[model samples]
Target: MACRVLEYLILPLVGAKTLIVGAKSVNYMKKNASTALRVRWSGSIRGGYSSNHGSRFYFTFDRAPCTGPAGIEAVDWTGASRNYHQHIEFEGLCNNIPAGHMQIGFNVGTLPGISWQPYLGWTTSGKPKITAEEVDLGENKGMCPHHTVFNVKQHTLATADTDSGIYGASAFRYTKLAPDTSLRVRWFGALGAKSQSPAPGCLRFYFTFNGEECKSPTPIDGAIAWLTDPIIQTRTTHSSQGDYAVALNVGQCLFGNLNQMDPDPHVNDVSRIIVEEVRLGKSQFAEQAVLLTCSFESSSICGFTQSTNDDFNWTRRSGGTSSSYTGPSSAYSGSYYMYIETSSPRVLGDTAVLYTPNLNLAGGCGRLVFRYHAYGSSLGYLRVKLYNGQHMTQQLWAYSGYSKNTWQETNVYFKQGGNFQIAFEGVRGRGVTGDIAIDAVAVFNVSSSYCNSPNRDLPKAAQQVFNLRHWNWYNLNFTGLGEIKSMIYPKISSTSGLRVSMTATVMTSQRLGPCTQWQFRFGGHVCPVPTHSVEGSRYTYSYQTTTQHLFPITVSGICTGLPAENLVLSIHTSSCGGSPAVDAVTGWQTSFFVSAEEVVLP
Candidate 1:
């Protein structure tokens, strides 16, 4: 058998503007950011040999795992921190020879791209053969998703089956990607931590990358995945064997481990999930995505009019209220998206109401109560009072500002059925009132189980479902300059602005390479501003890409302006002469927050 241990490094190269990438050789890392904790590790098996049922490779980190490919070290595998990485290739192995009879192979780790799969194989008379047929790849063993071949970059990898094991060989072909194209993007996923057992099928995965909260230096509170089950396919059907189908359960919840499963399995038990090879089928590739928007068409207009009581005469509604988009009163069918902000200072005897129609349709699951989003602290939390009229209030739910700006989705099932309603009324502080955008009000079986279990993606950790949203785009064009609306909830501290200023990530096309001539163009620049008027809060950014770095080129910029206006974020012609500049953020006052490593597309 022939095997080769190959590896690639995701170096956290310094940015022209700024960069916080860690060492390429690190395995486990723990650092205290401004307001949040940042931990990164390597889940891939350090390029190596074929072990038996007994021999294995292992590792561990001091802190938990972060998202995507992080750094890895060779030490963290001793005692207390018990994590192990193994390579069980039963096919056959030759001494570590580049061109011998037996060959062993492994990828360093993956980068942000969709095309290309990696594996181990052998070569001889110009003919290559595959091995390792008996490993149960479908099962969730020690191996995880990143180790599988299916997770390789889609551009250069293809799925090919052999008599023994499956492999996605790099067709030894070099095809140039569309310049300024992002190889991998946040097209699909549920946010936050999730479970892997008793499988819940497909977890809600989101696509758009909102800016995260920046504490002091590094940006905190962005997409940090709770990884598990990096399994790869061996034969047919969806049956998991050794480590196939690395299952990731998605839910609508918070980012913390304790925030999802009470005991927090993800927080304690596992840190990372890595698998080996994956064959990218068109269908699998297509289905590997998250939705761009939330639905609010079937909203149950469940709030008391300001007509109730006397004195303050404010509306009695406390939960799931909205100002943006349309209220439930607008549409009797289809879908709608709206935001509900909170009004403060507390008014007594102020009961809220949710209006709903019988619709008289059969197979009705009941009023799908969807609170687009909410803000404030635990004490100042927005409480949703769901009622079936008779039982009056069936639930008193709170959407905290802890998971601020992030969109959370949960389907509420009505108990007494018939025409129902969902209302919000704050007892302390100002009652929940703002553009709590509510949409995709679906009519499903109102489930009151209160999953509380967040998904591996962002959709599950959110307290309010900000549907009709977007994902981290590949090669995207911003919709021009627009206002970025803040979520009803905010993570406020004197140090960090309950928010991080956002910039656009455009995908531009320009030929680049080892010989491509380029220089920094600094002087010729125009600027726009936000209405909030917070000076010195923004930063400008730009980059250079080669033929290797395609689209999905993320561009990150800081802001010096808040409450400013008409901020036009455009890509300039690089000194290398690239074509067409695409906008990243429509410049809308987005409800979500994001701070990412911006890569200028090829």
Candidate 2:
């Protein structure tokens, strides 16, 4: 049996030893004095046997606040102490055990304001073959402050063993300070050796403050280094030592807050709470805000001007350039882009420069994002430069050569600490068969992580190769002419909330192309139809007989570890006006095969 002091109360004395009520006063250490002074105590003190381990019995206690009831003057009470005891009947617990030696251990903790000097002494009813360790009564010592650093070596297993790799939860008391004070937490961890998938395991950090769960604003997600892939199948017995950096943000603290790690399943182990630094001053990398935006789709250049000192001016045109095999077939997003033609008075090595309006970046670092199109065999070079003050000029980004003949996007990070502007300089290539264009320019006051991250708003490409692959084959058979039939097939399995994309192939004996309609649904979210018309409930498309048709389908809302539920793909065929049906005399057959790609949600 065991007992612990679960709560305490402060004793605020008026005089040397007197606690005065409204009309009565009590003095302690008196012969016949009535007990009138009281100290309030609360919270639970209970014991129970372990559910899984029959040999273990434990007790839990929570720290409660200390306060006086009423009718007492305020006293300079720095701390309080409590004590209790328990008696155990050991014969009943050892009835089924063989005659052998047993060991017992206990853990203890002190309250935030109080220091405890514990003296644990025990006595046995009869000193038989069993023995116990002698308890030591030591001197009282000061306890550590509220912000105690933890030094632990905890391990986490992959999802193959459990659903999630959550280590545990804990809280700490905080010294009250000003609002918006940054509480920075740093951690170092390592992954297992056998992690050989496209998505490796990493640590995740989260904290609760002011009654709300918060994550770091800089990392986009609280996941360290994009722990976006969670499918781990194989494992190794050993682990290698490596350093992994992670952080958490505790917005504003009042008294104390809770924090924990929800690490990826494949994470091997975490070392310690390495650092917990609190910065009370303003930081250089604050929150982000948009500074400027331009799409280059209007008659105006959005406060941009042509440099008179350059060789030529940039021309705003819609669609492709007049010269063939030299420019983009169409604008990247809209109807127009700023480009330069090299057919007229412009010769080889001619340069074109465009300048943005002066911007005040004295606050902090900024991110510049834009899209560029450099097609054709003789592609010129595009350089992005930063012009600051009267003479400081630095090239931020530059690209040359033909890059897949498609529109590509990039971003640059710069900090001038003063007034500045941006310049987009283009140099013509060997011949007039070169045209370079730029579009969708924008700037924002943000950290470098924003510029380094991929564009999240764009749709991810449908993939065919990944870990934990799933696929199946379905058939839709038809018979007789002018037959209108429909079928609904639920095709899904437990995906554990990973990002999934589906691709399908349909093989038919006869062409029912213009008369077929199909749709795929995951729970309440519907995947976009692959046909040309996206405005209808079900899209219609055509196909060729004896040929294979490929459909790329993207399913949304399967992220965040939510299971893909009630996934159904429906198809129907309608009678086309005056169109011949598929093999009226003999039955026609159609086979459908579907495969998927799964990855961790970003």
Candidate 3:
């Protein structure tokens, strides 16, 4: 809720230079004289929960402003098995200047400069090339509109243009993001037909941040294009349309322009472009107090509503339900959900419900979590009422008959003191199979035994060794330096006894008793904190006013000296200066993996 993590050094780089980082052994090198590059980083990082320990970072560079003298021969580290995030490569070369100016900067000596963003490419001699930096896709588009195809060796950006209103854009630019963070944008194409009338041949997304842009209430001229609800006309081939990631506190730069609009070029394409860092429960203090979540997977209906006196209105569907043996041939997670097909003008009890948008459980307690799908044999029934505006004040879940065919996961747990709204309700039964579906409908406020104890905050399958499920939230800028490296190999070959941990779950508007600082390093050791805590409870939420701290901060040891192949885990943080700077948001429902302890022999 408050922020700071700043430090900048343009590094002008001139004469006298020589460097080597991450050792490669050249007799430990040091021979180019002139004096200007030293660089050294050993291990032992440890320091989570904040108190500002040690703090020191100073490395400057900038010798070839544009066309001469640029030293820096080696600085390796790449992908390392890849998953959460990794890579730090740089070989160095300059002086040619056929016209390439140079501008590498992949960043992360101290994280937040937009949390390490780089994906620009160009080198026909104009310089400014950098390619692998992912979790989705960031910058990369110097040109691609002759009808489309920017494939610089498969980075992808297709098109056929097909006329209608004319469109073929593919621009992208993401930089310096911090505040609340969560921009994602993903892609995979389709839309040649299956559904495409006044719409479908779509992939319209346009955004600009900081200077402000993205009006989208459904804009096309004032622009605000697609923050969600874009399926490109429901499949025609390649899948994964992604495009429902937009949660920003606006810390600065972010520009995404992806337009593929084609009316019918033939098959339509979109290929790749990801920007992940998504988060949605499983940890991080167990999805703290979220009021509503909805995974209807856009194209509308994520707000859930129906009732002009319901008789036949609850069908956002996708996949099945034209008759057959009842609904759902897909979607329990994404692509769409929300149903009540019932076949032929519908009959029997005939109801359709669906409402939710009035939650205010500041302290009335809550927890909803949903997922449903009833299979065949003429089924019907899926209630879950609780209105409080005028009628129906509690039913909290009810299901009948066929409860399996796959999707089924419910957890109600409630208590209401004030505002409320949640309806659902679908009853139909007896006939063309009845249908009935629902999808990830989340709503949490905690406690009911931590909303049915879903691993109370993991790490104890006997010390556990691989958990991977990260959701990274952000906000911590002491002016400029930020850090968040991750790369865990842990298949165990030798870290001897193994032990490494880090816990976090923070939010604040004020209550700075130990602000929010961390400093953990894995493979190379220095992870010793033994144990730490502050979870004495302090939640309070209606939709964020801040005040949710649960810094379970625990760092164990016995790294046995460390090193098992690039293992890295670095997490650095700073700023306990007083108020403002403790909003780790704890990566949405938590998990930053790397733990070990299976050595049991009798």
Candidate 4:
């Protein structure tokens, strides 16, 4: 999305002279002044002026035209209400405009409250300048349309329009009114026995032109009426007879073909329009229907394909096999489920994939809902993936650990086009407990409420705040002493006031001796010790450590920082007698993460 253009004009008046200050140039005028005085102040003036009480002068500040990319506009001037002392303050303007070459123009004049000439100076103030761009404000971004796809049942009129006084017979009939016209249907019906009691209802209209059905279904309301009650002849009440008039654009209904050729060439140039109706029924426009459902109840497998990288394969089971395979006895809804079981005692890095049939998700959101079981000590992971024919695959949902032996349901949504399919993948861990199962898989085509709406990308300002959860971890494993491992963060320009917090998960075969201490250092400074610990086994222990550090790092242009900018998360175990290993066969591993955010000081 493009940035909104902001235009501002600063008008300063001194006697009869008016000074117009814009983002690009300053216009100055002097009334009743001599040609000599006008010639002296006709051109541009640079630098500050000294106080001269005898001469009356008016000043204006204007920046030159910016020579950069498009969508760059001038700074918004907040007028002269911010005048402090004798200086007219122009602050909070756009940072993109060049400030170094700003020209200040002055015109001499005489007016009241101008007994003393004001001095001007351009210098940096104590407060920090805002260098943020306008696009960072997250305004004027893309928005989705409220209604894009709808499915409504058709409705028809009860009485013929020839005898009805409201509409003619031609209005109810599907006729070609014009070359670019739409299909319109209007109907009126009686609500009760009398015309005094009103009972309103709704009607839906569907159109088909040239053997092609319309995509959008529209609904209309009935007209109001007043009818006399049969129980009390004198009592007359307001009621509604479901009366509706619907118009469907021929071009949209016929899939962009306004002038559809008639199938019967012998007939006239007019094309036939078939109409259907469903009266007094609620609109099902927003309700989405289930496009695909799989219960895994039969041996046919419901047209689902299974794949595996290794020898392990997903098996169809109707009952539990053994104690290790203590999962759902049957499927969530049926008596069968697709499960992947690893060989007992030893677990291998095995993967089993089950994919759905090719689904048509063009111009709509596809919702995949399924139930999964992942419960065991050494349980593996269950991941749901979406594959688009364009060579793009997205991981929709993933579960790694146990789920209390109960079936858990999850929903994943994605927007796709062309040919697409959803795949259920089960990764086997290193033990017999690496068993997982899936059942009750369903896919739905949800109506798009906001189709083709404008969407804005995350602004550069918000990207400065680094979340530790978002950073990818770099693992290191070793015994005895460890080297200083450094990880460089992605660089960002035009920033200052740097602060960072580091987090890590350290799993060791054994704990370091009480006397022997280990420390994590970054930027030549020792980080804080581990504050949290989780005990897994007698020889295996997991420690979570966190530490914060402030650095004087200033970045401008495309400048990369010093060695200190590259954070080093290392364990100084050489000084201690004990050895702490990371991600080794001795059951040790370490994962490091850092959260670095920029602080803009005012």
Candidate 5:
């Protein structure tokens, strides 16, 4: 049982314990004695995850507060469709959680793309695993300051795993911490909630704070790492500053709140108190952890706590004025998703727009960020313009000329002075040559992309090539589109130059003009475009690249055009056959290699 202690009433005398009342928690620990006393309520990311994703949906334990929780665990996943899934054990303004809805996300990887597969539904009857809801725990209250919850996360990869290669992780899920807060710890449960009597074996893991401070290289001198399980994971012990690095764990703490005590939805953290995910395989093993956190000095009558929420707003913004987004897929009830026909080449000013709900900008600032793809040609462009939707106002941050179909990201921020309209505008080939796909769009009042995903890993391109050396391309019949799908690579590096290894598939000695382009950038300079050729169905290409910061890659440009005979003309860009300015073309290729170091150059 992953539990984040919401409120802790420490008394010098240990006779009485506190009790959960309707909207508040009573500290009876002092009963008739008269001494100093303290109580707290907090919550945190439990059960589900502490990161961002596009596949599995997330739920909120509903308790991320400095108050206490007052509910048991056990919920209904039905009716969760379209809106808040029943009464979540969460805190509201009056509860421990910070006002409205607060969340602490997590990442726990899983099968790349298996959830879509068919599954047989079943209804096996067994005794209630945990305690059932006695009543609507925190019914009439907005927040609960008397509940305890522990968040557990399970993450998954987006792209399907069809190839066999070591693909660097594109996501992070495990013990995550709020950047500003370092006093918290993460804990996991080895077994499901066995008996509430505190399972002795539950604490097999250890959370070594400041584990990144080892002067000598030793097994125990690194950042907080874990006992590698089905979820193969090492340790990364450094953040932006070298002071200390963050690590995952099996122990973490959270506070319970009064408003978040509704047992109906099974406080979002309850189910995730233990989780499993797919690191390289289909999912990480089921996980269980207890969270430990400290109390904050808020008002005299209250202490501090964490939140256990996983409610994200991937909700496609509306065509007009829109705000909050709910679950069950589809954008919010009032918004619309604009899918550009970028499916092909077109110059239609396609844009995706959304507005933040009327936030109290009078107090703080608002920001927006989202994932992007397709970064190569200077001709391909996506100008993300944030309109002040308030009309006459200025837009937020904007980026352009990223690429064609590669995946990447961009950010925009706005001050409290004006409202804004965030837009991803693609002027591809002047808005007519390629495609761009966007996911996980968000606007945070406090943090930026961080809120969109807590334990999220910045994405990296999975490079690969179809070269003759890897396979024989002559037997094209052996490998078709279906087989190509299985050729997905996590990464492909070549000292002699990477190329499509389709030997087992086909070989077309009958020179067929081959044409295709991968997205690339030159860090304000030009890149040594790689070269490729068709020796049958197997395409081969190679080139060396200069180290640069321009690798914010998006998608591999998938190009198909003209007739079979035209293949001859497609190989050489110098084969320029069109007019001067209108159809001007250049016969150039680029080559790239992973830089020796993944660090900012001095």
Candidate 6:
């Protein structure tokens, strides 16, 4: 037997009508007698059952707007009640043996206007139960707003047990506001549930607005014996063209109780699913555009500079220019290709160079890509070098000898900062048959290192050495003792060690004997043995009698976490028999090279 109850509240004096449509019923009333009759409607459903049973309720009303009850506005489900024409609410209870279930829900037809909000509430007893709160009915049309229902129920078993029992209840309502000039949506709702069982239990809540699903439902899973935190979610979506949708989901899981003696171990499990808040708004996506793009197909070198040496230069040549050239007739992609070639009787040392305009690489790593063609019996060598300044250069790529007659693409990576140029040099070989060509050069900054890699040739133990930190090549005549402090070497913050190498040549103008001694000290410490004695002599009649003695020493020490500072080298000289002078000749006559390198220990 089933127990069902129906209740109605009507105000006939206000031109109101009450009707029951299917399992759901609605009561409608006009705001006033003078103005166009605006009907106010509310829907509800109640039922009690045992075993497997479920039911759905629906309510509908004409497209009419009426102000809600003055005193009841603030207490309405949506908090701030407005003029609405339709609302729906439902509740249900289940009583049976271990295997029993019940479900109830309310649905309504579509209504006019875009302003609408839905509220939800749910409660349950015991654990180890699975439940889904809401589902999408259909699309939203102007007629009656699509109907979305909220429902809650408990699972049951086949056998009856006095200790096994389950019950659930839920309610919800919705209202629409005045339509906005732009596309937008605002929705709010509250739903809750609970279960207790040894097996896992789950619950889910769904919401939809403006014909689109907002976000997926939030799910809660239950443990063997655990309680979940209250779940409250809110969402808002806005669009300039009313082309958006909003939705929410809530779920919970309740694990079965192992200690329970009852056949239905889940009878002792407990859980809850609640949606305390839900909101939806509107939004639009912004537009975007590319900043720049370059392709050398139009004969535009893209700001690359070309230079030649000894009348040998890279010139743009079309296909079929010569018989020995069997590569692409045009550029790698465009209709023109830049190539360097020697005359029939080529000069062995003739050279040609191509340079790219200064490029900014401070952003990070950068890539230089180009296609080259090198064929024929006597192929000249081609090399790519990076030039930071007039004297600082790094070779990036090099190639020589014959290759496939087809174009081969090459990519070069560099990490140096600031403006720098890339140059390609082609050297003439023994025969005039050598011909080289390049095309499609591109240089661009990259977020990641394209060329930075460990030096495989350097032993692992030596890879920690930093670049040449400080160095000084001195060429000055020293007649007596002299202290030489090399230039100040700035140690980077990460420097852990320093390596120093010094070489000095002593040239005596007159006769030299073993009595002359020279001492070299680094950082206040003697580099080698304290004094090195010179014992030989060279007599030159035309020039000053010159006898040279070479002193070379290499040493390293820990920096001890010191700040960047200068390193000084002191040279002491003494003559026991005759004066020995430190020669300072511009060329190779006399020279002192002192260099220091910073090292980071592993």
Top TM-score hit? 2
- lDDT of each residue in 1-602, candidate 5, tens digit only: 11121111211212112211121222222211111111111111112111111111121233322222322221112211111000011111112332222222211222242221111101110000100000111221221111111122322222212111111122243343222111212111111111112211111111232443211111111010110011111111221211232232322111111111111111122211112111121111100110111111112101111112211112222232121121112211112332223323234443333232333433235444455444333234445543444343553444555443433445444454444334444443443334343443444443233224333321111001111111111111221111121222211111112212110101111122221122222221112231212111111111211110000010111111110110111111111111111111111011111111010000
**True-structure lDDT of candidate 5:** 0.21
Clashes of each: 195, 3, 33, 26, 157, 67
Point out where model 6 deviates above 4 Å: 1-300, 308-311, 325-327, 451-602
Q: Judged by lDDT, which candidate is best?
A: 3
Candidate 3 structure quality by residue, lDDT tens digits, 178-215: 22222323222211211222321223222233323333
Candidate 3 stretches greater than 4 Å from native: 1-288, 291-319, 323-329, 332-336, 347-351, 355-360, 363-386, 389-419, 424-438, 444-602
Report the C-alpha lDDT of model 2 over 319-358, residue by residue, as the tens digit. 8998887877777645788888877677878999998878
> In angstroms, what RMSD does candidate 1 have relative to the true structure?
22.3
Off by over 4 Å in 5: 1-339, 342-362, 375-380, 389-392, 447-602
If both were scored by TM-score, which would come out higher, candidate 1 or candidate 2? 2
TM-score of 6: 0.29
Candidate 4 has a TM-score of 0.30
lDDT of 1 by residue, 380-416 (tens): 3345555454445466456544424444545443344
TM-score of each: 0.28, 0.33, 0.22, 0.30, 0.22, 0.29
Order of the predicted models by lDDT, top scorer first: 3, 2, 6, 4, 1, 5
Cα lDDT of candidate 1 equals 0.23
| Candidate 2 stretches greater than 4 Å from native | 1-287, 389-392, 448-602
Q: Which RMSD values do the candidates have, in order?
A: 22.3, 30.1, 26.5, 32.5, 30.4, 38.3
lDDT of each: 0.23, 0.35, 0.37, 0.34, 0.21, 0.34
Candidate 1 local lDDT, residue 328: 29
Local accuracy of candidate 4 as per-residue lDDT tens digits, 166-248: 32111232222122112322111111111111222111112223323332221111111111000000000111222223222
lDDT of 2: 0.35
If both were scored by TM-score, which would come out higher, candidate 2 or candidate 5?
Answer: 2
Weakest 10 consecutive residues, lDDT, candidate 2?
1-10
